[model samples]
Target: MLRTTIMGLCLAAALASPAAAHFQELLPSADVLPEGGTVDLDLVFTHPMDRGPHMQMEKPLRFGMLREGQTTDLLPKLVETVNGGKTAWRTSIDLKEPGTAIFFVEPKPYWEPAEGKYIIHYTKVVVDSFSTGEGWDEMVGLPVEIRPLTRPSGLWTGNLFTGVVTKGGQPVPYAEVEIEFVNDGSVTAPNDAFITQVLKADANGTFSYAMPRAGWWGFAALTEAETTMKSPEGKDVPVEAGALIWVKATDMGKAP
Candidate 1:
Protein backbone atom coordinates (compact mmCIF):
# COMPACT_ATOMS: atom_id res chain seq x y z
CA MET A 1 0.00 0.00 0.00
CA LEU A 2 2.84 2.40 0.79
CA ARG A 3 4.51 1.72 -2.56
CA THR A 4 1.28 2.38 -4.42
CA THR A 5 0.77 5.63 -2.50
CA ILE A 6 4.28 6.76 -3.35
CA MET A 7 3.78 6.05 -7.04
CA GLY A 8 0.50 7.95 -7.02
CA LEU A 9 2.13 11.01 -5.48
CA CYS A 10 4.92 10.95 -8.05
CA LEU A 11 2.39 10.84 -10.85
CA ALA A 12 0.54 13.78 -9.41
CA ALA A 13 3.70 15.85 -9.28
CA ALA A 14 4.52 15.05 -12.89
CA LEU A 15 1.05 15.91 -14.00
CA ALA A 16 1.18 19.28 -12.32
CA SER A 17 4.26 20.31 -14.28
CA PRO A 18 4.72 19.27 -17.87
CA ALA A 19 8.07 18.63 -19.46
CA ALA A 20 7.02 20.37 -22.70
CA ALA A 21 7.63 24.11 -22.87
CA HIS A 22 4.88 26.28 -24.27
CA PHE A 23 6.11 28.92 -26.72
CA GLN A 24 4.19 31.33 -28.89
CA GLU A 25 5.96 30.76 -32.19
CA LEU A 26 6.40 33.93 -34.24
CA LEU A 27 8.79 32.44 -36.78
CA PRO A 28 9.81 34.16 -39.99
CA SER A 29 11.32 32.59 -43.09
CA ALA A 30 14.35 34.76 -42.55
CA ASP A 31 15.24 37.26 -39.89
CA VAL A 32 17.14 39.43 -42.33
CA LEU A 33 15.65 39.85 -45.78
CA PRO A 34 18.49 40.89 -48.01
CA GLU A 35 17.59 43.11 -51.00
CA GLY A 36 14.12 43.75 -49.63
CA GLY A 37 12.37 40.46 -50.27
CA THR A 38 9.14 38.91 -49.10
CA VAL A 39 9.03 37.14 -45.74
CA ASP A 40 6.84 34.18 -44.91
CA LEU A 41 5.73 34.19 -41.29
CA ASP A 42 4.09 31.52 -39.19
CA LEU A 43 2.35 32.23 -35.90
CA VAL A 44 1.41 29.38 -33.60
CA PHE A 45 1.29 28.23 -29.99
CA THR A 46 3.20 25.07 -29.25
CA HIS A 47 6.07 23.34 -27.54
CA PRO A 48 8.67 24.44 -30.05
CA MET A 49 11.45 22.16 -28.86
CA ASP A 50 9.25 19.12 -29.02
CA ARG A 51 7.58 20.30 -32.26
CA GLY A 52 4.38 18.45 -31.56
CA PRO A 53 1.11 18.52 -29.65
CA HIS A 54 0.41 22.08 -30.68
CA MET A 55 -2.39 23.86 -28.88
CA GLN A 56 -5.28 25.32 -30.81
CA MET A 57 -5.03 29.08 -31.23
CA GLU A 58 -7.99 31.33 -31.79
CA LYS A 59 -7.93 34.50 -33.85
CA PRO A 60 -5.45 36.79 -32.16
CA LEU A 61 -6.61 39.87 -30.31
CA ARG A 62 -4.03 41.95 -32.18
CA PHE A 63 -1.38 41.29 -34.80
CA GLY A 64 0.61 44.05 -36.40
CA MET A 65 4.00 45.52 -37.18
CA LEU A 66 5.81 48.70 -36.19
CA ARG A 67 7.91 50.45 -38.76
CA GLU A 68 9.47 53.83 -38.24
CA GLY A 69 7.20 54.57 -35.25
CA GLN A 70 4.04 53.66 -37.18
CA THR A 71 1.82 50.66 -36.53
CA THR A 72 0.37 48.68 -39.45
CA ASP A 73 -2.50 46.33 -38.84
CA LEU A 74 -1.74 42.79 -40.02
CA LEU A 75 -4.59 40.94 -38.40
CA PRO A 76 -6.83 41.34 -41.39
CA LYS A 77 -4.28 39.52 -43.51
CA LEU A 78 -3.91 36.43 -41.32
CA VAL A 79 -5.07 33.20 -42.93
CA GLU A 80 -5.97 29.96 -41.18
CA THR A 81 -3.47 27.18 -41.54
CA VAL A 82 -2.39 23.96 -39.89
CA ASN A 83 0.89 24.00 -38.01
CA GLY A 84 2.27 20.92 -36.29
CA GLY A 85 -1.06 19.33 -37.14
CA LYS A 86 -2.92 22.02 -35.19
CA THR A 87 -4.75 25.17 -36.20
CA ALA A 88 -2.44 28.16 -36.53
CA TRP A 89 -1.90 31.35 -38.55
CA ARG A 90 0.23 32.21 -41.57
CA THR A 91 0.98 35.46 -43.34
CA SER A 92 3.49 37.07 -45.62
CA ILE A 93 4.76 40.60 -46.11
CA ASP A 94 7.06 42.24 -48.60
CA LEU A 95 9.70 44.77 -47.65
CA LYS A 96 9.71 47.55 -50.19
CA GLU A 97 12.32 49.71 -48.54
CA PRO A 98 15.38 49.53 -46.33
CA GLY A 99 14.39 49.73 -42.69
CA THR A 100 13.56 47.62 -39.63
CA ALA A 101 10.19 45.93 -39.22
CA ILE A 102 9.13 44.65 -35.84
CA PHE A 103 6.24 42.20 -36.05
CA PHE A 104 4.22 41.52 -32.94
CA VAL A 105 1.22 39.46 -31.88
CA GLU A 106 -1.08 39.52 -28.90
CA PRO A 107 -2.67 36.12 -28.70
CA LYS A 108 -6.05 35.55 -27.13
CA PRO A 109 -6.08 34.33 -23.55
CA TYR A 110 -5.37 30.61 -23.58
CA TRP A 111 -6.95 28.56 -20.81
CA GLU A 112 -4.83 25.76 -19.42
CA PRO A 113 -6.40 23.34 -17.00
CA ALA A 114 -3.10 22.06 -15.65
CA GLU A 115 -1.96 25.50 -14.60
CA GLY A 116 -5.51 26.65 -13.79
CA LYS A 117 -4.90 30.02 -15.37
CA TYR A 118 -5.07 31.88 -18.66
CA ILE A 119 -1.89 32.66 -20.59
CA ILE A 120 -1.34 35.60 -22.91
CA HIS A 121 2.03 35.95 -24.57
CA TYR A 122 2.90 39.23 -26.21
CA THR A 123 5.34 37.87 -28.79
CA LYS A 124 7.57 39.79 -31.19
CA VAL A 125 10.26 39.14 -33.79
CA VAL A 126 12.51 41.62 -35.57
CA VAL A 127 13.30 41.48 -39.26
CA ASP A 128 15.85 43.70 -40.88
CA SER A 129 15.33 44.49 -44.51
CA PHE A 130 17.96 45.26 -47.18
CA SER A 131 20.94 45.25 -44.89
CA THR A 132 19.71 48.42 -43.23
CA GLY A 133 19.54 46.81 -39.79
CA GLU A 134 17.89 49.81 -38.22
CA GLY A 135 15.69 50.12 -35.15
CA TRP A 136 16.01 46.58 -33.85
CA ASP A 137 15.72 47.96 -30.34
CA GLU A 138 12.39 49.69 -30.85
CA MET A 139 9.87 48.86 -28.13
CA VAL A 140 6.40 47.59 -29.03
CA GLY A 141 4.96 49.00 -25.79
CA LEU A 142 3.48 45.73 -24.65
CA PRO A 143 2.16 45.24 -21.12
CA VAL A 144 5.01 42.84 -20.48
CA GLU A 145 7.91 43.02 -22.92
CA ILE A 146 11.53 42.09 -23.40
CA ARG A 147 13.32 45.02 -24.91
CA PRO A 148 16.34 43.57 -26.62
CA LEU A 149 19.62 44.87 -25.29
CA THR A 150 21.39 42.95 -28.03
CA ARG A 151 20.43 43.20 -31.68
CA PRO A 152 17.73 40.62 -32.25
CA SER A 153 18.96 39.62 -35.70
CA GLY A 154 22.18 38.45 -37.38
CA LEU A 155 23.54 36.60 -34.34
CA TRP A 156 25.99 33.75 -34.56
CA THR A 157 26.08 30.63 -32.46
CA GLY A 158 27.66 31.07 -29.02
CA ASN A 159 26.81 34.78 -29.11
CA LEU A 160 25.32 36.14 -25.94
CA PHE A 161 21.84 37.66 -26.30
CA THR A 162 20.57 40.07 -23.66
CA GLY A 163 17.30 41.84 -22.94
CA VAL A 164 15.54 43.82 -20.25
CA VAL A 165 12.24 42.69 -18.80
CA THR A 166 9.71 45.43 -18.34
CA LYS A 167 6.17 45.72 -17.03
CA GLY A 168 4.24 48.90 -17.70
CA GLY A 169 7.39 50.65 -18.93
CA GLN A 170 9.18 49.88 -15.65
CA PRO A 171 11.93 47.39 -15.18
CA VAL A 172 10.96 44.12 -13.56
CA PRO A 173 13.94 43.14 -11.49
CA TYR A 174 14.61 39.46 -10.97
CA ALA A 175 11.96 38.51 -13.50
CA GLU A 176 11.91 34.84 -14.42
CA VAL A 177 12.68 34.03 -18.07
CA GLU A 178 12.35 30.74 -19.90
CA ILE A 179 14.39 29.73 -22.95
CA GLU A 180 13.80 27.09 -25.60
CA PHE A 181 14.97 26.21 -29.08
CA VAL A 182 12.75 25.38 -32.02
CA ASN A 183 13.55 21.70 -32.47
CA ASP A 184 13.21 20.15 -35.92
CA GLY A 185 13.39 16.61 -34.47
CA SER A 186 17.18 16.72 -34.71
CA VAL A 187 17.89 17.26 -30.99
CA THR A 188 16.86 15.55 -27.80
CA ALA A 189 16.96 16.58 -24.17
CA PRO A 190 18.59 14.29 -21.63
CA ASN A 191 15.96 15.20 -19.06
CA ASP A 192 13.01 17.50 -18.55
CA ALA A 193 15.16 20.26 -17.12
CA PHE A 194 17.16 20.47 -20.33
CA ILE A 195 14.02 21.06 -22.34
CA THR A 196 13.44 24.53 -20.91
CA GLN A 197 16.33 26.53 -19.51
CA VAL A 198 15.21 29.02 -16.90
CA LEU A 199 16.96 32.27 -16.01
CA LYS A 200 16.27 35.40 -14.01
CA ALA A 201 16.91 39.07 -14.62
CA ASP A 202 19.38 41.07 -12.58
CA ALA A 203 18.63 43.96 -10.26
CA ASN A 204 18.33 46.19 -13.28
CA GLY A 205 15.95 43.84 -15.09
CA THR A 206 18.58 42.70 -17.58
CA PHE A 207 19.28 39.06 -18.46
CA SER A 208 21.53 37.30 -20.94
CA TYR A 209 21.95 33.79 -22.30
CA ALA A 210 24.55 32.34 -24.62
CA MET A 211 23.38 30.07 -27.39
CA PRO A 212 25.36 26.89 -27.88
CA ARG A 213 23.76 25.79 -31.12
CA ALA A 214 22.50 27.52 -34.22
CA GLY A 215 18.74 27.83 -34.68
CA TRP A 216 15.87 29.90 -33.40
CA TRP A 217 15.73 30.58 -29.66
CA GLY A 218 12.87 32.13 -27.77
CA PHE A 219 13.08 34.12 -24.56
CA ALA A 220 9.98 34.37 -22.41
CA ALA A 221 9.78 36.60 -19.38
CA LEU A 222 6.87 35.48 -17.25
CA THR A 223 4.82 37.46 -14.75
CA GLU A 224 1.42 37.31 -13.14
CA ALA A 225 -1.18 39.58 -14.68
CA GLU A 226 -2.42 42.56 -12.73
CA THR A 227 -6.04 41.49 -13.00
CA THR A 228 -7.80 38.14 -12.86
CA MET A 229 -9.92 36.68 -15.66
CA LYS A 230 -12.85 34.31 -15.69
CA SER A 231 -11.99 30.68 -16.31
CA PRO A 232 -14.07 28.10 -18.15
CA GLU A 233 -15.65 27.06 -14.88
CA GLY A 234 -17.04 30.55 -14.36
CA LYS A 235 -14.55 31.32 -11.59
CA ASP A 236 -12.07 34.13 -11.57
CA VAL A 237 -8.45 32.99 -11.74
CA PRO A 238 -5.08 34.60 -12.12
CA VAL A 239 -3.44 35.08 -15.51
CA GLU A 240 0.12 34.45 -16.62
CA ALA A 241 1.48 37.18 -18.84
CA GLY A 242 4.58 36.41 -20.86
CA ALA A 243 6.85 38.73 -22.78
CA LEU A 244 8.34 36.62 -25.58
CA ILE A 245 10.95 37.35 -28.22
CA TRP A 246 12.48 35.16 -30.92
CA VAL A 247 16.02 35.38 -32.27
CA LYS A 248 17.87 33.32 -34.85
CA ALA A 249 21.47 32.25 -34.49
CA THR A 250 23.56 30.94 -37.37
CA ASP A 251 26.50 28.62 -37.66
CA MET A 252 29.94 29.92 -38.58
CA GLY A 253 31.00 27.09 -40.88
CA LYS A 254 31.22 27.33 -44.63
CA ALA A 255 29.01 25.11 -46.70
CA PRO A 256 30.65 22.12 -48.33
Candidate 2:
Protein backbone atom coordinates (compact mmCIF):
# COMPACT_ATOMS: atom_id res chain seq x y z
CA MET A 1 0.00 0.00 0.00
CA LEU A 2 2.85 2.45 0.85
CA ARG A 3 4.60 1.62 -2.45
CA THR A 4 1.40 2.34 -4.39
CA THR A 5 0.98 5.78 -2.74
CA ILE A 6 4.65 6.60 -3.28
CA MET A 7 4.38 5.64 -6.95
CA GLY A 8 1.29 7.84 -7.38
CA LEU A 9 3.10 10.80 -5.78
CA CYS A 10 6.10 10.30 -8.02
CA LEU A 11 3.88 10.26 -11.09
CA ALA A 12 2.14 13.47 -10.03
CA ALA A 13 5.49 15.16 -9.39
CA ALA A 14 6.74 14.14 -12.78
CA LEU A 15 3.63 15.54 -14.44
CA ALA A 16 3.97 18.80 -12.46
CA SER A 17 7.53 19.47 -13.66
CA PRO A 18 7.91 22.45 -16.04
CA ALA A 19 8.60 21.58 -19.64
CA ALA A 20 11.93 22.42 -21.29
CA ALA A 21 11.86 25.65 -23.30
CA HIS A 22 13.43 26.73 -26.59
CA PHE A 23 14.23 30.25 -27.79
CA GLN A 24 14.39 31.31 -31.41
CA GLU A 25 17.51 33.32 -32.12
CA LEU A 26 17.31 36.33 -34.41
CA LEU A 27 19.70 37.21 -37.31
CA PRO A 28 20.19 40.61 -38.99
CA SER A 29 20.40 41.07 -42.77
CA ALA A 30 21.86 43.26 -45.49
CA ASP A 31 19.52 45.29 -47.70
CA VAL A 32 21.93 45.16 -50.57
CA LEU A 33 25.41 44.03 -51.60
CA PRO A 34 26.58 47.04 -53.64
CA GLU A 35 27.88 46.34 -57.11
CA GLY A 36 30.94 48.51 -56.50
CA GLY A 37 31.34 46.22 -53.45
CA THR A 38 30.05 48.53 -50.72
CA VAL A 39 26.89 47.67 -48.85
CA ASP A 40 25.22 48.24 -45.48
CA LEU A 41 22.94 45.78 -43.68
CA ASP A 42 20.15 46.37 -41.18
CA LEU A 43 20.12 44.52 -37.90
CA VAL A 44 16.54 44.15 -36.85
CA PHE A 45 14.83 41.79 -34.39
CA THR A 46 12.21 41.97 -31.69
CA HIS A 47 13.61 41.27 -28.24
CA PRO A 48 11.26 40.83 -25.30
CA MET A 49 13.53 41.27 -22.27
CA ASP A 50 11.19 39.40 -19.96
CA ARG A 51 11.17 36.27 -22.07
CA GLY A 52 12.88 32.96 -22.70
CA PRO A 53 16.18 34.02 -24.31
CA HIS A 54 16.63 37.45 -22.72
CA MET A 55 15.34 36.09 -19.41
CA GLN A 56 15.07 39.50 -17.70
CA MET A 57 18.84 39.29 -17.51
CA GLU A 58 21.28 42.10 -18.22
CA LYS A 59 24.27 39.91 -18.85
CA PRO A 60 25.67 41.10 -22.19
CA LEU A 61 26.02 38.95 -25.29
CA ARG A 62 28.63 39.33 -28.08
CA PHE A 63 27.77 40.28 -31.69
CA GLY A 64 30.24 40.89 -34.52
CA MET A 65 30.55 40.31 -38.30
CA LEU A 66 33.52 38.80 -40.09
CA ARG A 67 33.70 37.85 -43.81
CA GLU A 68 32.52 34.87 -46.00
CA GLY A 69 33.89 33.82 -49.38
CA GLN A 70 32.18 32.73 -52.63
CA THR A 71 33.13 30.47 -55.57
CA THR A 72 34.68 32.51 -58.43
CA ASP A 73 38.12 34.06 -57.96
CA LEU A 74 36.41 37.36 -58.41
CA LEU A 75 32.93 36.18 -57.65
CA PRO A 76 30.73 39.01 -56.45
CA LYS A 77 31.86 40.04 -52.99
CA LEU A 78 29.33 40.27 -50.23
CA VAL A 79 28.86 40.40 -46.57
CA GLU A 80 29.94 36.27 -34.90
CA THR A 81 29.80 36.28 -31.48
CA VAL A 82 27.35 35.98 -28.61
CA ASN A 83 25.90 39.21 -26.86
CA GLY A 84 26.19 43.09 -25.24
CA GLY A 85 24.64 43.05 -28.20
CA LYS A 86 26.88 46.62 -28.32
CA THR A 87 27.71 48.98 -31.20
CA ALA A 88 31.28 50.04 -30.50
CA TRP A 89 32.13 46.43 -31.23
CA ARG A 90 30.68 46.48 -34.77
CA THR A 91 31.55 48.14 -38.06
CA SER A 92 30.84 48.01 -41.84
CA ILE A 93 32.99 46.83 -44.79
CA ASP A 94 33.77 47.60 -48.43
CA LEU A 95 34.30 44.62 -50.74
CA LYS A 96 35.72 44.98 -54.28
CA GLU A 97 32.87 43.08 -56.07
CA PRO A 98 32.07 39.59 -57.46
CA GLY A 99 31.13 38.01 -54.15
CA THR A 100 29.42 34.67 -53.62
CA ALA A 101 27.53 32.99 -50.80
CA ILE A 102 26.96 29.33 -49.94
CA PHE A 103 24.31 29.18 -47.32
CA PHE A 104 22.08 26.09 -47.06
CA VAL A 105 19.94 26.43 -50.17
CA GLU A 106 18.42 24.36 -53.01
CA PRO A 107 20.44 22.71 -55.78
CA LYS A 108 23.11 24.05 -53.52
CA PRO A 109 23.75 26.75 -56.17
CA TYR A 110 27.39 26.05 -55.38
CA TRP A 111 30.02 27.10 -57.94
CA GLU A 112 27.30 28.41 -60.24
CA PRO A 113 28.16 32.11 -60.62
CA ALA A 114 25.60 32.91 -57.88
CA GLU A 115 24.55 31.57 -54.48
CA GLY A 116 23.04 32.46 -51.08
CA LYS A 117 23.96 32.99 -47.42
CA TYR A 118 22.57 35.13 -44.66
CA ILE A 119 24.35 38.33 -43.61
CA ILE A 120 25.76 37.83 -40.15
CA HIS A 121 26.71 39.78 -37.02
CA TYR A 122 24.58 42.92 -37.23
CA THR A 123 23.27 44.02 -33.76
CA LYS A 124 19.89 45.68 -33.85
CA VAL A 125 16.92 44.59 -31.80
CA VAL A 126 13.37 45.66 -32.60
CA VAL A 127 11.56 47.43 -29.77
CA ASP A 128 8.02 45.99 -30.01
CA SER A 129 7.08 42.40 -29.37
CA PHE A 130 3.98 40.31 -28.67
CA SER A 131 3.96 37.61 -26.00
CA THR A 132 2.65 34.07 -25.71
CA GLY A 133 2.48 31.33 -23.07
CA GLU A 134 6.10 30.38 -23.61
CA GLY A 135 7.51 33.78 -24.63
CA TRP A 136 7.35 36.54 -27.22
CA ASP A 137 8.03 35.74 -30.87
CA GLU A 138 9.92 38.10 -33.21
CA MET A 139 7.81 39.30 -36.15
CA VAL A 140 10.43 40.92 -38.35
CA GLY A 141 14.05 39.86 -38.77
CA LEU A 142 16.80 41.03 -41.08
CA PRO A 143 16.93 38.16 -43.59
CA VAL A 144 19.83 38.33 -46.01
CA GLU A 145 22.17 35.76 -47.59
CA ILE A 146 23.75 35.49 -51.04
CA ARG A 147 25.67 33.30 -53.46
CA PRO A 148 28.24 33.84 -56.22
CA LEU A 149 28.50 30.13 -56.84
CA THR A 150 32.17 30.11 -57.58
CA ARG A 151 34.51 27.17 -57.10
CA PRO A 152 35.98 26.85 -53.64
CA SER A 153 39.34 28.64 -53.48
CA GLY A 154 41.09 25.52 -52.33
CA LEU A 155 39.70 22.46 -54.08
CA TRP A 156 40.89 18.95 -53.43
CA THR A 157 39.97 15.36 -54.27
CA GLY A 158 40.52 14.61 -50.60
CA ASN A 159 41.13 17.04 -47.72
CA LEU A 160 43.64 19.91 -47.57
CA PHE A 161 46.50 20.55 -45.08
CA THR A 162 47.04 23.54 -42.88
CA GLY A 163 49.19 25.33 -40.11
CA VAL A 164 52.56 23.55 -40.00
CA VAL A 165 55.05 22.83 -42.78
CA THR A 166 55.42 19.71 -44.94
CA LYS A 167 58.04 18.78 -47.51
CA GLY A 168 58.96 15.57 -49.42
CA GLY A 169 55.47 14.25 -48.53
CA GLN A 170 56.00 14.55 -44.79
CA PRO A 171 52.66 14.66 -42.91
CA VAL A 172 52.97 18.01 -41.16
CA PRO A 173 50.46 18.18 -38.36
CA TYR A 174 48.82 21.44 -37.23
CA ALA A 175 49.55 23.19 -40.52
CA GLU A 176 47.19 26.07 -41.36
CA VAL A 177 45.09 26.22 -44.55
CA GLU A 178 44.15 29.58 -46.06
CA ILE A 179 43.02 31.52 -49.16
CA GLU A 180 44.04 34.95 -50.51
CA PHE A 181 42.31 37.18 -53.09
CA VAL A 182 44.60 37.94 -55.99
CA ASN A 183 44.32 40.00 -59.18
CA ASP A 184 42.81 37.63 -61.69
CA GLY A 185 40.02 38.65 -64.08
CA SER A 186 37.56 39.38 -61.27
CA VAL A 187 38.45 42.70 -59.70
CA THR A 188 41.09 45.29 -60.63
CA ALA A 189 42.92 44.50 -57.41
CA PRO A 190 41.83 47.19 -54.98
CA ASN A 191 44.48 49.07 -53.07
CA ASP A 192 42.83 47.98 -49.83
CA ALA A 193 43.14 44.30 -50.69
CA PHE A 194 45.35 42.52 -48.20
CA ILE A 195 45.86 39.01 -46.87
CA THR A 196 43.35 37.73 -44.35
CA GLN A 197 44.56 36.15 -41.13
CA VAL A 198 45.83 32.60 -41.28
CA LEU A 199 43.07 29.96 -40.97
CA LYS A 200 44.03 26.81 -39.17
CA ALA A 201 42.84 23.29 -39.95
CA ASP A 202 40.64 21.34 -37.56
CA ALA A 203 41.20 17.78 -36.41
CA ASN A 204 39.16 16.62 -39.42
CA GLY A 205 41.99 17.96 -41.63
CA THR A 206 39.85 20.89 -42.64
CA PHE A 207 40.74 24.56 -42.79
CA SER A 208 38.38 27.22 -44.09
CA TYR A 209 38.22 31.02 -44.29
CA ALA A 210 35.59 33.56 -45.35
CA MET A 211 35.98 36.09 -48.12
CA PRO A 212 34.51 39.62 -48.02
CA ARG A 213 35.13 40.67 -51.60
CA ALA A 214 34.66 39.30 -55.12
CA GLY A 215 37.72 38.68 -57.28
CA TRP A 216 40.20 36.13 -58.47
CA TRP A 217 42.21 34.75 -55.54
CA GLY A 218 44.28 31.73 -54.68
CA PHE A 219 44.46 29.11 -51.96
CA ALA A 220 47.60 27.51 -50.64
CA ALA A 221 49.04 25.73 -47.67
CA LEU A 222 50.67 28.68 -45.95
CA THR A 223 54.38 28.01 -45.80
CA GLU A 224 57.76 29.49 -46.58
CA ALA A 225 58.28 29.42 -50.34
CA GLU A 226 61.63 30.02 -52.10
CA THR A 227 61.54 32.54 -54.94
CA THR A 228 64.29 33.59 -57.36
CA MET A 229 65.46 37.12 -56.61
CA LYS A 230 68.01 39.37 -58.30
CA SER A 231 71.15 39.68 -56.17
CA PRO A 232 73.13 42.91 -55.92
CA GLU A 233 75.81 41.16 -58.05
CA GLY A 234 73.11 40.47 -60.69
CA LYS A 235 73.03 36.83 -59.63
CA ASP A 236 69.93 34.79 -58.79
CA VAL A 237 69.20 34.57 -55.07
CA PRO A 238 66.45 32.66 -53.23
CA VAL A 239 63.73 34.71 -51.55
CA GLU A 240 60.84 33.51 -49.45
CA ALA A 241 57.15 34.08 -50.45
CA GLY A 242 56.46 34.63 -46.78
CA ALA A 243 53.77 32.47 -45.11
CA LEU A 244 51.51 32.35 -48.16
CA ILE A 245 50.64 29.98 -51.01
CA TRP A 246 47.72 30.40 -53.44
CA VAL A 247 45.13 28.71 -55.69
CA LYS A 248 43.51 30.19 -58.79
CA ALA A 249 40.76 32.80 -58.41
CA THR A 250 37.35 32.43 -60.07
CA ASP A 251 34.23 34.51 -60.75
CA MET A 252 32.39 35.00 -57.48
CA GLY A 253 29.07 36.64 -56.56
CA LYS A 254 26.83 37.43 -53.60
CA ALA A 255 23.03 37.60 -53.50
CA PRO A 256 21.29 40.91 -52.94
Identify the leading candidate in terms of TM-score. 1
Model 2 whole-model lDDT (C-alpha atoms): 0.28
Question: What would the per-residue lDDT of candidate 1 be over residues 1-256, giving only the tens digit for each residue?
Answer: 9999999999899987765667999999998877888999999999887776799999999999999999999999999999767889999999898999999999999999878899999999999999687899999899999999999998889999999999999999999999999988889999778889999999999999999988899999999999999998999999999999999998988220
By TM-score, how accurate is candidate 1? 0.94
Candidate 1 weakest lDDT stretch, 10 residues: 247-256
Which residue runs does candidate 2 get wrong by more than 4 Å?
A: 1-166, 176-178, 183-195, 202-205, 225-256
Error of 2 at 253 (Å): 8.7
| lDDT (10s digit) by residue, model 2, range 162-235 | 22233322433455543444322344323322322345544533454544444322333433323444444565
- For candidate 1, the per-residue lDDT at 222 reads 94
Please name the candidate that would achieve the greatest lDDT relative to the true structure.
1
> Model 2, 214: alpha-carbon shift in Å?
3.8
* Cα lDDT over the full model 1: 0.92
